[model samples]
Target chain A: SAVISQKPSRDICQRGTSLTIQCQVDSQVTMMFWYRQQPGQSLTLIATANQGSEATYESGFVIDKFPISRPNLTFSTLTVSNMSPEDSSIYLCSVGTGGPNYGYTFGSGTRLTVV
Target chain B: AQSVTQPDIHITVSEGASLELRCNYSYGATPYLFWYVQSPGQGLQLLLKYFSGDTLVQGIKGFEAEFKRSQSSFNLRKPSVHWSDAAEYFCAVGAAKLIFGTGTRLQVFP
Candidate 1:
């Protein structure tokens, strides 16, 4: 098991502003992912951040909307650019090791409310 | 395309009662299945997962699930419910890129 933490556990921002959420893991992990949970909806994968490489985004998600940065094995940041009320929701970061079947550990999540 | 489905939107259960949450998936191949719990104002925590062999998998916090390949289902169950168990539960499939279901919100009453 690993202890994961996110900064700005909860935040409220004005529309058109951008916020960068930070994810730090207690130990080094190979795979770090960013997810978005819309109000009353399921979570959607935003992208996968790997050290020394650009993030891999899902079909509906793009780097321009959600820019990601992975500077090391244990840390990653996701910047929600051009925020809107629709972007108000919980953002989660999960860390996992690659394999056929493996477990995932997630940060407590950042609750963002864009007004 | 890979997708996960959690049919139930909200489930209310009395405390100390048994509980079961339904989930189903559609994928091209044998898929990895997982159950995760998210308390209000908290990130999601892994409840259990099934990747292969064992059809039944045990998870922390007294949660268990069984995988049915024929039905494309992985359902979560608990013998007795606790008020603390009131939270949102999500079912996910796929290993590299997890596709999560809409989620089931569990409500517990005294």
Candidate 2:
């Protein structure tokens, strides 16, 4: 299993502003996933990042709205652009441990509040 | 399309009482099930997962889940509920990309 260090555990930003959340993994991984958990809602996949490649966004999400950067195997960043009150949610990063069972490790998550 | 369903939105139980949280998932291929607990202001922690072999799997915090393929269900169970066990539990199904259930919020009363 890998441990992830996420920055800005939480933040409050005004509408129309952008916030970038970062996740650093202790071990190298091939793919990292970004998820959004809205208040009182289940988690939804935002995008999947692979090193040196553009992220693959989910159907409802877009690259412009939620840009992702996977600079290397151990680090990734997700930026929420043009924030709105609706953008307020908890963002999480996860990496899968390749094996027979394929276990996944998740970051602490960033709680963002757009005013 | 893959999906998960957690019927219970909230569940309240007394300390030391047995607890069960229901979960159901729909997927075309062999399903990989997982249970995760999320505490307030904390990260999601894996409680248990079922990939193959035995149907019943034990997890941390004395939690266990039984995967029933015929029923398309993976329900979480605990012999005795603890106050610290109060949290939101999510059931997911998938390998690389997961589809999560709505989640069940447990409230333990001492």
lDDT by residue for model 1 (A1-115), tens: 7689898798999999999999999888889999888877778889999799999998888899899999999999999999989999899899886655467888888989999
Give the DockQ-based CAPRI class for model 2: high
- What C-alpha RMSD separates each model from the true structure? 1.6, 0.8
- Tens digit per residue, CA lDDT, model 2, A56-99: 99999999999999999999999999999999999999998887
Q: How well does candidate 1 score on lDDT at residue A70?
A: 95
Tell me how candidate 2 scores on lDDT. Answer: 0.94
Interface root-mean-square deviation, each candidate? 0.9, 0.6
- What is the TM-score (0 to 1) of candidate 1? 0.94
Give the range of the ten consecutive residues with the poorest summed lDDT in model 1 chain A: A96-105
Model 1 ranges with Cα > 4 A deviation: A99-101
Best by DockQ: 1
lDDT string, candidate 1, B1-110, tens digits: 78887888999999999999999999888888889898877788888988888899999999999999889999999999999999999999986778899999999999
Best by TM-score: 2
